[model samples]
Target: MLKKSHLLCLCFSSTLLSGVAIAQNAVIVNGKAIPKTQLDKLVQKSGQPDNPQVRDQAREMLVTRELIIQEADKRGVIQKESVREQLEQSRVGVLVAAVFEDYVEKEGVTEAELKATYESMKSQYSGKEYHVEHILVEKESDAKAIIAQIKSGGNFEDIAKAKSKDPGSAPNGGDLGYVNEKSLVPEFSKAMVQLKNGQVSD
Candidate 1:
């Protein structure tokens, strides 16, 4: 027969053992302890057997998260003003994104407007085309001489291939590919725009 104190100790030990057993049997993922039923629900939601690779990945992510939490605990980061401010900012960003998405869904561009816009910009979408030849020289006089030769019926492409100072374009007879208005320097673009088909510019 046990004394009252011994009986009390036995009850306490039993309670502690039960708690340890519960903890040992629990499944923790990403810092949250989940019951077996909950894990089964998750597997059902995923519509597949929680494969070994997937379980390993989940365990790895949980371990990494625990490490981060432990380090943050040691550093007392949760109480920092910057952390609070960043959390608030993130909440504000979420709210803003939700509002913007709602606005877009409610007021999306009309089909008519889209078609009109496409028609208006159709000519601007010309396919890749290049029919340009140029000669570059260190001296402006040499450039002018080459332009004069081109004007006097000399083949500009041939002359550029033989005489242009720009090594990259010279090898290709100075034939740079189709460039839009924004692709060249302002002065170069202005000069190119003024040229007609087969015309040479100074």
Candidate 2:
């Protein structure tokens, strides 16, 4: 036989306690417990509105990520040989890059040093580029004959396709892309440099 006021107070106390427990159990991020706050922050950072549709999409994405992480954990993917190897490689790469960066900073690469290096090694870099066609023959004699045919206004590409031993260049009509002196063998490069543009050689 509780009084009406006492009964009301007891009910109110129970309700308040339950609310406090719920609040305590709730997870918070950035000192905020409201989902909308979280959504707003995400939207702000991403430059997109977390509308109902977007929220639903994000929820699905989070759920999928969680499921993947859970499955990975269960399957010990993090401890797998392949995964560990990849991680080790990544770690080594990062460490090497960091060390190189530190060394470069300490050594101080100057503009003058760079320019000097470039100038001294200019011949190593300098070369004439050519786009030439040729016929590759087994004997120097056959090659010489092909060169003669070319001098007599015969089509270099046609001759190459007809008699070139090199399968790779034969199909392309012996068209080698723009190659420089450095790109060719010593003898080949010397011969190439002696020729003018569009000139064929043995």
Candidate 3:
């Protein structure tokens, strides 16, 4: 019984409402509208297969975390000096990491820079590759102590397993396997090329 104009109007209204709902993908918790992006980010971080179950779990986690945060705010836990400092540090770390990632993606090494680096290190890359192992520590004092221990016949692999902070290589005795010298950072390449086989840098 609807007129042609009324039917067209109804269709238009339905299309707009559907578009808005699809764009928002809103998940409401109490009165809050949690963004779908947060759920997507959580799932990506979990490294799990993206399926309904994983999404449900992520949604539950977000809701619980939000509830706890709300409770903390109500009790003024965020006002504590130590908590404020920790939160600020976490914020800085996240922002700095994001900047580094964005910068690397948008400003990757140019061909000219690569050519210059290659030219400077051509001697080190004379058709010979090197297998590299390294133990990384935060302090020069720690590095010196490790070097001393190695000089006195302490096992390099054992020391690497115990002290190296590099998660990817530490478990494998700090072994980076075979690598092209040019692929290494300049300082590392310079030091590595100076070492004789089976010799550790002083």
Candidate 4:
């Protein structure tokens, strides 16, 4: 009993309703399909409970974002020069990071390389080391007297404690502890390197 135009109108309305229902089931926005995986990822990133309420909130956020993106695309905002440059820069940054990560995974440091580096650096720290002591005096005669006294079996540490003028070493019986040759003056280094173990330098 319906006229021809009414039948056509009914068919068109049915088609539009069918399209809208399909879009709702697929979570489409402006004909763009938004996957469920995206919602899962967003929920995981939010660090919230995986309950229905959280999922609904995340879905809403994604839908709103998609709407904004679609509007931006419609206005040609994405085609602007500055926006394109920024997008390119972001893409390059991501690519560079991925490349470095891949390179590290494929060509990482080996134990042999580490050992070689250690060997190469070892020599710099392997030079001569010395433990030394001294009795500082202003007069040559006093020095000779102290050395003669030590040579005659007088306790060198006791004599240094009593007479050495160096405030830094005097309190510890003139103990200089262990030192590297490079750290000493040339004259001291020469004298220290020449002495045998347990021998005192005059």
Candidate 5:
């Protein structure tokens, strides 16, 4: 009973309304669905084209990421007590930050208050900054031996890479990079502050 134009309009409106009710899915990876919304957001964030190539790339990335996450979940990675505790701590930190941000937005800070706070804390910031490399060992005897090697023209970094027990820095040749004087332990601070540049601690 409808005219051709009216029938076409009705069909288009029905499709439009249905689109509002249902989210377009981009892919399903191992039963996990990646919605078009996710792809759109990623594309927008990446500033990429909205074309088929970009969409397909997004789908591939989403699938890969989701599978890894699923594998981690299946392995009960999140079930460990330490991980759970850390996760709870991270959640608490985020919530606290959000609440603090909201409070600051609602109850604004005055320039005078900021100035007073800065004045009260300014003295805490001053300390000698040391840029040095260190090779740590369990025993003082071992440390002395390493220092002797360095003095005898052995490469400090190569020695550190070979022998430092501090796993994080050992791979990078025992570089602690720059550290402030107060941030170190009392013994280390005292020893390091007195050392001239290129001097190793004995």
Candidate 6:
């Protein structure tokens, strides 16, 4: 049977919902106290504004969840592999979060520490950026022919705009403006770095 406090928490404040308050600080469910902190989190997660309708809905949901959980525990349904694994995941997730919280609280981040960390991994934030142009084709033979044409005095942009298959850059004459070297594929970046200004890749 649902406790008086449980009904109160699950129902609207009005008598129409059969609500009966028993505790001022917590929702009592099957003689177990569900703390206000945990209850607030549950309500917040419901994504409902703090109004009578949402409050009542959140309460009903929490009550139903508790009842189902209690029934499952009593009947050993939680012992099944799937249920156990689900519960284990929840437990581990909570514990992991708690550990991170505790560690951060104990050894708080300082501006100096942040700067030091940033400096240590500055390569991630700082790199050689490049402006590039390329002709993309479906076949290697097409690429080789295109490269030969460029070598023989074809305008790279005109050729790229006419024949490059990469729709995004093709319209813009294959102009890839100020690319960070690290963002490109390894082989592409290697080839690109070998070229001087306004030089086309072979």
**CA-RMSD of model 1:** 20.8
Instruction: Itemize residue pairs with steric clashes in candidate 2.
Output: none
The count of residue-pair clashes in candidate 1 stands at 0
Candidate 3 or 5, higher TM-score?
5
Q: In what order do the candidates fall by TM-score, top score first?
A: 5, 6, 3, 4, 2, 1
lDDT (C-alpha, whole model) for all candidates: 0.65, 0.65, 0.81, 0.78, 0.76, 0.76
Each prediction's TM-score against the native?
A: 0.36, 0.38, 0.40, 0.39, 0.59, 0.42
Q: Mind giving the per-residue lDDT tens digits that candidate 4 earns over 40-124?
A: 8898999988998998788778777877676667779899987888799999999999997897699997889779989876754
Candidate 5 Cα misplacement greater than 4 A, ranges: 1-24, 40-61, 67-99, 116-128
Q: Which lDDT tens digits does candidate 3 get at residues 1-202? A: 2465673221111111135654564366555667778888999999999999998899778877766676667779899886898899999999999997897799987789889989877866667688999999999999999999999999999999999998778888999999877788999989999999998997
Q: Pick the candidate with the highest lDDT.
A: 3
Among all windows of 10 consecutive residues in model 6, the one with the lowest summed lDDT is 9-18
Our tally of clashes for model 3 stands at 0
User: Candidate 5 on 44-146: residue-level lDDT in tens?
Assistant: 8878768879876776677777776676687797898867888999999999999988988999888998899897666545655788778879998998888
Model 4, residue 123: C-alpha shift (Å): 26
Query: Where does candidate 1 clash, by residue pair?
Result: none
Which ranges in model 2 have alpha carbons more than 4 Å from their true place? Answer: 1-126
Worst 10 residues of 5 by lDDT: 8-17
Q: Give the TM-score of candidate 2.
A: 0.38
Best by TM-score: 5
Report the C-alpha displacement of residue 175, candidate 2, in angstroms: 0.8
Candidate 6 structure quality by residue, lDDT tens digits, 1-202:
3565674333222122223442332355676555556657767888877776776676666667777777777778888886788789999999999998897899887899889989876865488888898878999999999999999999999998999998778888998878877778999989999999988777
